[model samples]
Target: MTMQLLLTLLLAVARVKASTLLASHYSGQLYTLSLSSTNQLSISGSISSGNRMPAWLDLDSASRTLYIPDEVQWGQPLLKSFTVGTDGAVVPKEQIQTSGGDLHSTLYGGPNGKGYIALAQYDASAISTYPLPLTGAGQPLQKLTFTMPQPGPVPSRQNKPHPHSVFTDPSGQNLLSADLGADLIRVFRVGTNGTLAECSPAKSGAGDGPRHGAFWTRGNSTLLFTVNELSNSITAWSVLYQPGGCISLLKRQTTSTFPPGKSAPPGSKAAEVRVKDNFVYATNRFDRSFGAQEDSIATFSIHAASGNVTFVETTSAHSFFPRTFSINAAGTLVAIGGQTSANVAIVERNVTTGRLGRLLASLKVGNPGAANQEDGLSAVVWNE
Candidate 1:
């Protein structure tokens, strides 16, 4: 072949490796999402997650599997597994009963290609650890279970322990669970045998109701950024690694998820919080009771040295109830899921300023069950 022709063929192959975005919904389906050159998003394919509400979605690329919680019925929570194909298709594999209901899960990559799948149950107020098998056929075996403690200020949501999410630390030797009802980020030491042991917690301001969190590290300092649902704000905590590999979090700063002087409407709550580059993005959602609402994504610039956050600006999400969003690996695009609108929107990001540009794409995915209009988009994940 001619050298020119060879080079052209190589470029085309490289383009095919571009990342694909996946979105899960309250409708009980997961869609393979793609954004075209024309800035239009298309659903390439979809897999049914059954009737259960897959409120959270995450991919384990190393194992080529997807983990989801089946909280369809109270007192009968399940952990579902699926094999993710190269073309972004998913095949349902196994479903095992978990320790509790309303669970959110994540995989911990551990020693020798063997690790555990960690789940946090909201209704049961517990964390369950299980052995992750490579075959993806048999039921998962439980290794340990930890009941989370609830300490509160908000009477409505803080009536009990509510573990919103579970995350494996970068060190692979610890775990962090964001307890929304407790106003604390609890730390746990991951034993070599996959058991969990409690450690000192990083406390948030009362009534904060800390939800989900994302971590970023620079040098020896690791920072955890969490979204506060009740307060409509975000908090940053500096992590201190102890001598025995245990860790603690110290609150560094908190900032409103809404624009300055613009009080969030009543019943307003903050949802997902994500970090990319030196910036953090969070969603602000409000109930329909607020006539003129401000449902948007607030972007903030993070100081690398101090892990402090400064509000940059708020950008309209182009829809209501943006429950979740994912940034492409390239850091040039962001996909947001509007739960109440049953639609997804894409926006461009300014890498230099960390400010969002105008919305580039918007399309309705339709609600899960009926053909009618009712928002149900739940979570979004970017697979690069």
Candidate 2:
């Protein structure tokens, strides 16, 4: 190979080896940042969609593309796509209008080797599927609509079916959705053609608003845990595969996300949950009025054999309303984004001790919106 060709090959390998964190803001901007070998964070580049605030973000490493839902509360909703350049800059590729529904979450995965993006709409009470080259956006291939069969205990928040998050099972045979308004974890069988077949919906306690979940296998069992927004608790379930390839989620344990003898302050709600080996971490959103009292990330220690989790300790997120966080691919750094604080908090993770070190740095991300506005941070994603 020529000297220039060899140099290009080495550079490509180095870029792929570095870890990246993608932060989605509610101000219609998406920022790409990277963690260096010594754990320093630097802004790479960003892309914005005008005033169409981008909410949830999912990245396909193989395609080097990012997917987001245009959650314009006062305008039309859309699905936007972007290509991640070699320098970690995002370039707008395509966008498709989703009519009137407001999309809240999106996940990219499928069972039969077919790529797909699963979409959830909280306002429309629907789950839809879009086939992916993800090169260009267009209409969804199929949509499954739902209604609230019965009202949840919290009338104000659960009067309708509000699907908050959607993800495919690690087994690749089932698609699971956490419905916040209906208090149910809906499950669907993944078909070869990317269609969904109705399966048993995992029922939760009446006031337990299921928002997001994490799945992992331990021993001979597959485990799933969800963060409850309304009740401020965590629910653990054992995923069992039945005959003819069906699935069931049996409750294993339920525990408060708060520390022992401690109660969550008023207006505090759980936001996201993530697991890394023996340690699991989750974030909470609180009214900015509560200030430092309610802004925290609760940590839990998981029992390797039982699939049960114990509240470890609560760490101050160093900012307000930590809506989302991500652990880097090397599992050495944790990046947290504060929605109300409009900043990103970075903490070092001691993998050997399973304890997070003190705050190392914070990055201001977007324009600070009014108290009632959500124009701050929304999601944080990490990939190598």
Candidate 3:
């Protein structure tokens, strides 16, 4: 290893204590993130990948490995894993070749936090489940792919396998894949040893273009809320939990994201949707247009029982493209990430009523776009 690389590792370990970071790849490398003692200071760290691109990073607690959706021309995009040393150097662990084309995003965990990775080939639509190992290095998973129901009413776009994001159900009995191209959410059932059992499909209503989704809170709830990139809105759905190993949608309704104006373009979808406490936050991106640089964070109060969301307030933070933001372990501060600015904004939130405040300390991103909108901020990972 080069001396420069070794020095980079030592600096990272000093900046963060008691918390690890989520590394995002963009502008050609992955960025490390962390918060201050008060969860205010947002820090960025990076490790170079000669020609490999790091995308859609996931922290696998069971394996203590950071998984990156890496693209290398030699073969296919891999679910590459790494071990973070005590001094913060990320040592490569495993590079599992995905059978179902390029691995998109590490699917959100099920009710039990059982990890699964979702693979989506643009021309095809499906989800694959990788059993999260119980301990030690994460076990290599055999791709258990679930092709979506093609003959549904909206078969034109829905005909192909276009899985975007995957997550397990609150009961851990089901897995769901949000199909952006198809505008439908696919569901599945899981076994103890990480086997998937098929079941019913819970629709996300018409043309919502579901992107990344999450529940109102952890454990126990029929409320499933998802971020719809096309519709430029977030929606709530009441799940009719059934006894026959199936879940039916009870209701699907939308919430406002932007003020009445030109709708979001086709490609730049809603980035990351997260639910902390009773508040659900969505970050809508302009990717290219970069028009409304004023209003960013869309805050909504979540109703867990009815699966409904009411507008709390839209943050006027001047972030270019806020993609992903995470509340601190104390839920006091939220670290906001911009896909275009390549910088993170540290914002404070009132956990009681879902109000937000800007923080004092901010970490300017490294390797910033010495150029333009083609690059900006990546994802944000917080340390407790």
Candidate 4:
């Protein structure tokens, strides 16, 4: 064989191996997908979740446990846990009934040095905490409810307090909830024995409707960046870690998620926000103006000192209504789940320039549906 041909064969043999990805669908299924080094995608396995709308998933790598929240709007929702086997099989472990509309959850360490699951119930206007290693249908250790004194600027969406997401801060001492209906980022202190105490909330712009957030730390500074669904904007806040396991978010900058001089379409809404290295990425849904086929993912460059972000560019998601997406551990590929398109797209990413490249692969997993109807894909997560 020729020398060049021999080198090519060797490179192919040494290429990155395929990885596993877990995706949640509104059709009550958890799918295990195989992602090849060449960026191809295929469903390897799937299991029924036994719930109507398992809309969000949180995987605890340390325990090989996956937490799924049933985003049911009508009756009481359920929080289910499963053991993820080595072969990608998910075995149900426990299921607990919770207040309706359990949309998001996260695992965090409590003051007792044990782990706890913090859940956000949007329709219920409540937050709940449960101890880790769920065994049975146990009750929550603490449940907190919120009431909005007045309607927000956007009365339609902010008529009540809706906590969209609950996440642990960088300090690992506090929990923050993005209250979309109240225009506040509610702070909570994790106390001994996995209890939660309410703290002063940080205010956002009127009608911002903060849905989800990601944190970035530089030296001693930590910044919280939230994707506002109502305003179609991104806001950066300086996270101040205070004594007694609490925090204060001071607003730093607010910028449109769309490109400069461009705004979101009438029905468009910002979905997800994520940070990798020095770059931040946010998604916009129902905006076909950017792409003929689907919505767009907005990229921004983060200023090291101020934590302010500058708009980088927008890239087509290659699928309609990109509700959720996950970046691999290598940060080289993005797996996007289109909520209304019922498809998953793998796109190349540039770690150095913070720019998204061409679409490598796309797979149709199920049937499509209307926006926010809970009839398609809900979450996509890498298994690394």
TM-score of each: 0.87, 0.89, 0.76, 0.93
Residue 235 C-alpha lDDT in model 4: 95
List candidate 4 stretches off by more than 4 Å. 1-15, 74-76, 111-114
**Model 1 C-alpha lDDT versus the unseen true structure:** 0.75
Model 4 whole-model lDDT (C-alpha atoms): 0.86
Candidates 1 and 3, the one with greater lDDT: 1
Query: Candidate 4 on 269-384: residue-level lDDT in tens?
Result: 99999999999999999988556658999999998976779999999988889999998766778899999999999987876788999988888876787876768899998886
Residue 9 error, candidate 2, Å: 26
lDDT of 3 by residue, 1-384 (tens): 987676556535534554445546465466555454454544435665322545455665545566665433344545666676533456666555554334355544444464555454444354544554323333444454445555444465445556677766666667777777667667766655556566766566566677777876535566777888666788787766778666766556787576445555554456678878888888766534435453367788876565567777666444666767777665656777666556667776765677777653556575554222434555666532
TM-score of 1: 0.87
Candidate with top TM-score is 4
lDDT of 2 by residue, 300-383 (tens): 888887778888887777677788888865566788888877778888776655677788777778765544356778777775
Q: Best by lDDT, which number?
A: 4
Worst 10 residues of 1 by lDDT: 366-375
What is the lDDT for 184 in model 3?
Answer: 68
**At residue 378, what lDDT does model 2 achieve?**
77
What is the full ranking by lDDT, best candidate first?
Answer: 4, 2, 1, 3
lDDT of 1 by residue, 46-138 (tens): 878753677677677767788777555555555777888766777887676654455577777468424777777776777777787534433
